[model samples]
Target chain A: MSFLSFLLGEKKTSASVAKDRLQLILINERRGSSAGPDFLPQLQQELVAVISKYVKINPDDIKVNLERQDSLEVLEVKIEMPQPEASA
Target chain B: MSFLSFLLGEKKTSASVAKDRLQLILINERRGSSAGPDFLPQLQQELVAVISKYVKINPDDIKVNLERQDSLEVLEVKIEMPQPEASA
Candidate 1:
């Protein structure tokens, strides 16, 4: 808020507070790329393998993408799972 | 955690949950740049103006930096503030 409060040693220094805020924004920008961390492919495989146990799903049915929304870095994963066969 | 729970209609779709996580990471990355948003200059000026009211501070005394640590984006602002004159 105000530096005067900081001068009185109320809580944390103004610099500390500013640093926290600035770093938060920087991290968001870095994660916004659609081609995110190298482990994404592995993550997808693991997800598909786990999800396949419950429903019939093709690997292509799963789609994962990274997006940026103002202060938010969003990961979107979509899956098209087929209905299980009707029990006789 | 598990997609089977999602199929049971517990709360949200797996896609929605994934989206939130993805976006968060992206936002952090975006904000991690040392040469951050264009508004930084204005922000520095405003901060200095506000802080100067209480103590003698030079613009250079304030340093703003953005750094990334794993999933955390840190904004560091260091300011050197002079002590105020003691009142009798």
Candidate 2:
């Protein structure tokens, strides 16, 4: 399931707000966790490198982040793949 | 971290297409599997029941979908949480 889907509720709710809310939650959930020892950036970078073989990516937006909740350890990779350019 | 985040890239891309792309990719990624057969819907409903404790949800939109990749099994969920109406 996607984050937007998580926040997206009801036919009345706009997808715009859903996008914003999901981003906030996902970021906070992921960032709030790196309180412990982690080599997450390295791992993220490597994952991006490996996955890039199958997709075109924008390096800067490829976020290698982690989230920590109680005893749970979650590693999240946000890959910003390039959009196809509009053809004139 | 999230599907939208995965498709969101560069300074020029629109969030509109990002939302759509993420939805397709996630649905396809999750639903593309489960070819053999699994009790996914039942699992989804129960999962939603458990998670809804902390969230407001629209039961109908809580899709219990699945996707299967080679040697990889993924259960994807789409939860449509309630949105606060306008203050008007």
Candidate 3:
């Protein structure tokens, strides 16, 4: 009966599995610890590369920050776009 | 010569077009103005609904916030997940 109960109770749903994955990803992203690599710098570099294809921009013109506030996980992406040409 | 120059200068590259679209979307998302709908609440609701499938959670347990810090646009999603059962 105990073995049967363990078998029945141990079954995990797909939703639970997804929850576990999301938790792991979010924790890794938030902590930027030894558990996993930090992805923000790569994200910033990619953003710069993509945006640079259209307009000439300095690498410093883009900023990416990941912050935690209370229970919230915030990902901020800032790109200082070039101003349009001034009309005469 | 003037008309030819205008024709040449007026052509927009796909990259520039993509930049324009991204700018518009970001602007709309950041401002939550009349130009476009705010997606944060819907995103929160959807997140709650999805997570609720695996774990029982209150609607207030999740918070979503979009904030602008200088040129940066921040999207924060916070979920207070339920604690696991204490091991015997």
Which of the numbered candidates is closest to the native, going by highest DockQ?
2
Q: Compute the TM-score of each model's chain A versus the native chain A and list the values.
A: 0.36, 0.48, 0.38
- The candidate that wins on lDDT is 2
- What DockQ number belongs to candidate 1? 0.02
Candidate 2 has an lDDT of: 0.36
DockQ of each: 0.02, 0.03, 0.02
Please provide, for model 2 over A1-88, each residue's C-alpha lDDT reduced to its tens digit, 9 standing for 90 to 100: 3433443323644423211100111111221222334434453444345444434556665554565544333445544333334434
Encode model 3's per-residue lDDT on A1-88: one tens digit a residue. Answer: 2222221233445432221100001211112112223343454344345445433455665555555433223344554433333425
Separately for all candidates shown, the number of backbone clashes (residues 3 or more apart, or on different chains) is 35, 8, 0
lDDT of 3 at A3: 21
Q: Which sections of candidate 1 miss by over 4 Å?
A: A1-38, A68-73, A84-88, B1-88
Looking at model 2, the pairs that clash are A33-A68, B30-B66, B30-B67, B31-B66, B31-B67, B32-B68, B33-B67, B33-B68
Q: For each of the candidates, what fraction of the native contacts does it recover?
A: 0.01, 0.01, 0.00
lDDT measured at residue B12 in model 3 versus the true structure, 0 to 100: 50
List iRMS (one decimal) for every candidate: 23.2, 16.0, 23.3
Query: What's the distance in Å from true for residue B79, model 1?
Result: 33
User: What C-alpha lDDT, on a 0 to 100 scale, does residue B17 get in candidate 3?
Assistant: 23
B71: Cα error in model 3, Å: 7.8
Clashing pairs in 3: none
